[model samples]
Target: MYRLFAGIEIPREIGEELQAISKKVTGASWRPIENYHITLRFMGEVDRNTAEDLDHELSLIEAKQMQLTLSGAGWFGSSEPTALWASVEADEDLTRLAERCDRAAKRVGLSLDKRKFRPHVTLAYCKGTPLQEAAAFAEKYGFLKLGPFWADRFHLYSSWSGKGPSRYVSEAEYPLT
Candidate 1:
């Protein structure tokens, strides 16, 4: 089975900016620069046939480019936060793209997480991190106000997590006009 997901890659410039602001949080395991992406859907583990089906369905998705902005920083989980993430504003184009991915996955008989799509690029994974400290750090950064980057493509990424930090490899690229 292949562990996979579909997401938009963050530009190098924006990743650098996010990396700069990721420090000073105690007990936080920061994500590597290459791992920064706005996940459209997490497809989890699937067999080769299912992956191929998803690839075919995804490639058929035709949508226009989206003006994406990386904005704000925050942590999920109320007490003892589990992750610190950079928020993404989901405009209509982004929403449509995500929906198309979701529909494709569903059509291919892949079960998806039922959570509402809250777009974010995870900055770090936290272990027993104090809520106040994380909250303070988030408040300090508040709104990130980064570029309105143009997203003309998204990818099918395979993750390898056995090592120190999870490594994401792009298995397929699907472009939008």
Candidate 2:
């Protein structure tokens, strides 16, 4: 079985800017810069044949390249904090791309996410951290303008993490024409 997901690849300069924000925000758990990505669809562990079929189906998605900008910050989970994330400003192209990915996944018998798609790059996963601290950290560095970039391609990634940083390896890339 393989754990897979589709996500946009962030450029190095933007990743560096996010890393700087991570350093400034104290008391909150920070996700490593290498793991920074905006997930489009997550398809959990599946058999090898299903994975191949998913890739073949995803290859047909043709979205026009769009510009994406990192604009704000937010948190996930209530009660006990679960994550800190950098939010993306909503754009038609981003939403359409995500919807196309969803449609592709559904065509291959994968379940579509019931929740509305909200795009963001997870900055941290909080474990027993105070919510107030996390919120404050977000407020302090949330206004960061990481500029913008053209998203020209998306990837089908294989996720792997044991004890250290989570690693995502791209198995296939689909270009947006």
Candidate 3:
């Protein structure tokens, strides 16, 4: 089985900007610069046949290239604060692209994600970090604003989760023209 997802890739400059503010929180496993992206769909695990079908379906998606902005900062898990994220703000183009990905997932016989599409690049995965520490980090650097950058393509990516930094390899590229 392969752990898969569909997402938009971040430019190297934007990744470097995110890397700058990734400090000041303990127990928050900061994601590597190369791992940054706005995930469109998260398909946890699937066998080879399903993966192929999903890939083919995703390739058929039609979307126009869009500009996205990394604006503000936030965290999930509220009091527990499970993650720190850099939010993405953009036109309906982003949502429409995500919807195409959703349709692709469903067309391949995968269950559609119930969560509403909220575009953001996860900056770090928190583990046992106190709410105070997380809050302070957000308070200090939450005003981060980066890019109204062009997103020309999305990808079918394979995720590798291990002890060190998470690894995501782009297995297929889908262009938006």
Candidate 4:
């Protein structure tokens, strides 16, 4: 079974800026620069045939080039603080593309995701990090702004989590017009 999702890659320049801002926080496993992306739909653990069907459905989605920006920094979870993430400011085009990815997953016979589409690029995975550290990071960089980077395409990404940070591989690319 392949673990997969549909997502947009962050521009290298903007990613570097995020990296710079996220440097102060410790006690978390930071995601590699290559792994940064805004997930559209996480279609977890499917057989080869199902992956193929989802790929075809994603390929059929028509999208135009759209701009995305990083508006702030925050962490997921409240008391436990499961993750630290950079917020992606929402765009209508971006949301529409995400909805299309959601539709593709449903078309491939996957169940609906209960969580609403909240756009974010995860920076680190927290393992018992102190709440105050996350709070401090939020206080310092919560209003951080990065870019209006152009997204020319989205990808079908395969994810694997084993030892360290999860590795994301781009299995297919769907270009925007």
Residue-level lDDT tens digits of model 2 in 1-177: 999999998888898888877754334567777788989999888889989999999999988998999998878877766888888888899999899888988988998788788999998877777778777877886786676898999999999978866789999999999
Worst 10 residues of 2 by lDDT: 21-30
Candidate 2 ranges with C-alpha deviation above 4 Å: 24-28
lDDT, each prediction: 0.91, 0.85, 0.90, 0.90
lDDT of 4 by residue, 58-171 (tens): 999998899899998889888988889999997999999999999999998999988999999998888888899998887788889889899999999999888978889999
Candidate 4 ranges beyond 4 A from true positions: 24-26
Question: lDDT for model 1, on a 0 to 1 scale?
Answer: 0.91
Candidate with better lDDT, 3 vs 4? 4
Candidate 1 runs further than 4 Å off? none
Error of 3 at 51 (Å): 0.9
Residue 32 in model 2: lDDT:
74
lDDT by residue (tens digit), candidate 1, 1-177: 999999999999999999999887788999989999999999999999999999999999999988899888899998789999989976988888889999999999987669888888999999989999899878977878788899999999999888699999999999989
Better of 1 and 3 by TM-score: 1
